[model samples]
Target: MSDSEETYKSIAVLGIGTVAAPLIEAGLLANNASVLVITRPSPKARQIPEGAHHAAIDYTDVSALTAAFRKHSVEVVVSTVNHEALDVQPAVAEAAKKAGVKLFVPSEYGLPSAGHTEGVLLVKSRFVDSLVAAGLPYARLYVGGFIEWIPYLFAINETGKFNIIGEGKAPATFTAISDIAGFLAYVLTHLPPSQLHNVSFRIQGERKTPRELAALYGDKAPLVEISEFPPSVKDGAFRKFLQVAFNAGFASTGYDAAEGKDDEKRAGSSNSLWPGHQWKTVKEVLNL
Candidate 1:
């Protein structure tokens, strides 16, 4: 099919874990799109979401994956697999290309590679390189972090507090999982390939610091000092690194590393891209 002829009426998504769950829901909600979740062969049955279809296949096998895509007439493929399964994404992309899929959304929903430490981030960056090298048309969504997991990231349940990684004032991006999924649905059905391909769509529900977040939650959540954080909480001494990184302007999009060479003054948001869609703020998410 020609690029212009490609329309996302039927799409296949790999995995239905945390991030994938909402994406599946959103996709199914698109009245015109038939959303299918691709799972590994049975003996392990997963509860398929209502209004969606499920298929079992050896996703790692490119030939099988391509066949599955062709069978489903999957015009678009979205990979929302977890970080550990990220290595399999390139193969998925390769299969999509072979199957003549028009668009691919890689599994990126966190910090931009520039802000990540080594390991997983490196693998993700390499995946992007593979996409470019293989000539695959893809969209990489960079959402700073999931707001739903923020409370746990800071261990709010046990300590009722979280550390201020940086100055505790920078407006770091955070998107509710539901909002991310909803936005993904909007993009898939509404955006044409010309608007969807080869882009870093940065979005955020709201940007707030630990201190500001504490205010919303009141005394229930307080800001703790990184110095007092337990040893187990240390992400390879990441606290210090993130503190420096966030202040150095690694917090949000619209960052031109060359322009002014200032990270603090940099800011941008794609929330305005879909003006009709309403986003959830941290306050609404926490029910505060």
Candidate 2:
């Protein structure tokens, strides 16, 4: 089959949150793919996008999820479930398997988590294990960090004071949310099963140090070196851990020396997978 030919005609997006929104609009729906947004039965109404189907199922019930997948003839299952709720993915994988789904894309749009032992990374790793155990073909996407969340990740407050975690010298990968969604939809529709199955696509739109990132804002954002994260921060402990990981260089698309030479060597950024597309940079996105 030609690369331009759509391999998966029916695509089911598991959530309608931050990531799923663009994936449905610019990515899947724009490409003219049959898109289905799957959400848990909610009392509140959801504004599902036009040109897409919506299925409200009890996510905890594997049989119900399986029926929904089968009813829509879903070929690919793209999960955008929040990291905290990733424990529910194993059951989702079971349903996908039972429904004979072609591919399973888990909710792993963050820093590399191959050998993580604790925190949400560990939870994501376990979900991949479940996919393997269930014998389901899967694709894992690692984009380091979303460009839209840079202010929050960098702890840059309203007054433009940037918190310098560690030395703020470690380089980290950043991709615009639109690029992440666009790239995902492109590859899923264009690439064949041999290239898509059980593979990790490490992509980055831009790479920059925290200091450099702050510098992009010029005099508007001043850097403040801090020994610890502020107490007022929401999810302070988790966010602090992520900052530490970024400082240790785990937040880059490329392999870091701190990870040890003996560690499993990861492939370099797969940004070329989507050839000829101009990737959005931090400066461009922030208008800096």
**Cα lDDT of all candidates, in order?**
0.72, 0.83
What local lDDT score does residue 65 receive in model 1, on the 0 to 100 scale? 91
Clashing pairs in 1: 249-263
lDDT score for residue 135 of model 2? 88
Off by over 4 Å in 2: 2-6, 256-268
RMSD of 1: 3.3
Q: After superposition, how far is residue 152 of candidate 2 from its true place, in Å?
A: 0.5
lDDT score for candidate 1 against the true structure: 0.72
Tell me the tens digit of each residue's lDDT in model 1 across 111-227.
Answer: 665334366666877787788788887887777667887676565765667655546665566788888887777777877787788877877777766567767776777676564
Please give the lDDT score at residue 217 for candidate 1: 73
Query: 49, model 1: CA deviation in Å?
Result: 1.6
What 10-residue stretch in candidate 1 is worst by lDDT?
259-268
- What would the TM-scores of all predictions be? 0.85, 0.93
